[model samples]
Target: MGTTYLTARLNGGEARYKLPGGHPLTGRSTPDLELTDDGRLADHLHGGRALLLDLTDDPELRALAAGYADRVDTLTADCPSRPELAAVLVRPDGFTAWAADVGAQALTSTAGLAEAPEKWFGVPAGAVTPG
Candidate 1:
């Protein structure tokens, strides 16, 4: 397969890519695979939509995930080594779009959660299709 790394800036930091499924915040994990309507997850998103892994149950954090659900499959689960993150955005190709740290400020800001969709999904909110 061709290289999956696509770089774009997020959260005021220059974009960085670790191989998909190779890092705590980058890879698809067991929970990611186990989560589905029938308890089966695809290795890659069949459609182009991004996926948001909401590892936290905090109402505020869940709301944060929901705000982005228009462009993502927001799933709540226990992730490995992600205690510091409120959530992680996984692209359709199973790569991380962005990661949110565990802070009320960070979780609540549009800056932390919004930038990745534009950078990764190439579509604005309420759009019916993604590029």
Candidate 2:
């Protein structure tokens, strides 16, 4: 009840949190897996910005995240262990700051996809995106 996993505004107010299910990786440590793009995901997480460890083919989410490329390192990789996770936003300290799940029924979002970097890292320079 105390730790709200979300930072983004929902309906102009904080999102009502529910435990149990969102994405398996939400609020947990990043899994030790080798991604296709990078040999290891943990390798890229040491940088200043959070890494968007995307595991699905969600172009809209990736495109939306792309706008703030200057604020994050988007890694599109396959998670063989938990393929259900659509994406996970990994903080620099190697924790899952947010996540989005794969399909309906269990379809989910932690609301940090677009807001986490601004919450953890400072605002982007003039809302600038990657060129």
Candidate that scores best on lDDT: 2
Best by TM-score: 2
Error of 1 at 94 (Å): 1.8
Give per-candidate clash totals: 1, 0
With a 3 Å backbone cut-off (N, CA, C), the pairs that clash in candidate 1 are 21-27
Measured by C-alpha RMSD in angstroms, how accurate is candidate 2? Answer: 9.7
Write candidate 1's Cα lDDT for 1-131 as tens digits: 12232222323223446442223555332234443333434543566777766666656655545655667776676544446666667777555656666664555455345556656656554548635
Q: Provide the global lDDT of candidate 1 against the true structure.
A: 0.55
Against the reference, the lDDT scores of all candidates come to: 0.55, 0.65
* Total clashes for model 1: 1
Q: Which segments of candidate 1 are over 4 A away from where they belong?
A: 1-48, 61-70, 122-131
In angstroms, how far off is 6's CA in candidate 1? 21
